[model samples]
Target: MRTLKAGALYFVLVFGAGFVLGSIRVPFLVPRLGARFAELLEMPVMLAVVFMAARYVIRRYALADRRTRLLMGTIALVLLASAELLLAFLMTGASPSAYVASRDPVSGSAFLAMLVLFAVLPALLPSGAVSDNPFKPKSVGGSDSFKR
Candidate 1:
């Protein structure tokens, strides 16, 4: 289903981006970057998930109402955030893991930020926007492609 594929794409976007960023040493600001980059590392994942979810709604589902686009973004963010947190657990004991939850800061910060970001994303998606938008009408002749 389109939704499932979208979700998978979101996961890949988040996981892949995080992994890649995590592996690279910042060219200009290595130490300082390491201290602040976790959230930045998450930006692409968040944007990709939201954009895709919005596209999914517009194309396959009904994004006619603003509520729908927001819903899609919310769902995408939640799924991505869940995947991130799970990764955090898997990473807790690694070498630089102390940099993560050191004295519980990462835990507390991640929890708050993830929830706020995911919860607000949908509501913030721009309305009446399109760019070769996939959310356009799926059927040209007033027909549902999947129905017989």
Candidate 2:
């Protein structure tokens, strides 16, 4: 239902960003820096995308319940993994096991960690902090009371 929709949107946002970043990283960064360093460089950007996308999906869908958020994250992870494997199969004729085995060990481990973070982030994020401004001070009195 709502969780499904939220999950799909989250997957689209993060996956789309990754696809674009991969496009750049493969042809440009990989040759210059090597796979491990290129992938390591890309990790921080992907992490930011994951965090922002998770926050956006949770807030937009009103996914306040912990179970609901977890379900959404899981759904998104499944979709993302499936899409990646399918693309790898089509592009390189690599089986899933072969595809995984081919990854640079250091970069691959980081990628695995990112995947775990992606799966759990929605559930872990606080639901109450809906304010757009991160630095806005909490209000103490009537006139300055923070407004949603």
Candidate 3:
């Protein structure tokens, strides 16, 4: 339930943030940076929101399960990248030369570095951090507790 709420919050934040940024930049940044930059910025924000959620999940439950967290993060990054690629096709009909060129060309390390940053930030919450879980487990009729 916390994850769902966090995801919903993430979606809303990213959606509204996109609109707000778009509206402000429609006449300026959008033209200078092109639709691609605006889009690239938006997707990262959404992914960050998701990462925030995942971080919360990790800290709140003390899951401490790196595999699950890493998988969740990798999935988010791939989805974001796919969305960016698809949006590139839709907006410009071709990928910008600058898009790939702007990064460090040393074995594609910079591009992969950004990917890693997004993939890992969510799991960097301070040790022993905790989140308030409103929908946490509750005791049933017997002594067993049901996980929400």
Q: Which structure among the candidates has the greatest TM-score?
A: 2
Q: What is candidate 2's lDDT per residue for 65-92, written digit by digit as tens?
A: 9889999999999999999999999999
Alpha carbon lDDT at 38, candidate 3: 51
Q: Candidate 3 lDDT, tens digit per residue, 12-97?
A: 44345445665676677668876556545555554565455656555554544455445545555565566556655686666645
Over all chains combined, what TM-score does candidate 3 have? 0.48
Clashes of each: 2, 0, 0
Given candidate 3, what's the lDDT at residue 115? 61
lDDT of 1 by residue, 18-128 (tens): 566555634444565654464455555655654554454454443444565455555666676666667666766433345344524563475457556554554565554
Whose lDDT is greatest here? Answer: 2
| Cα TM-score of candidate 2 | 0.89
Cα-based TM-score, every candidate = 0.48, 0.89, 0.48
Model 1 weakest 10-residue run by lDDT: 94-103
Model 2 segments more than 4 A misplaced? 130-148
RMSD per prediction, one decimal?
8.2, 3.6, 8.9
| Native RMSD of candidate 2 (Å) | 3.6
With candidate 2 superimposed using the best TM-score fit, by how many Å does residue 102's alpha carbon deviate from the native?
0.6
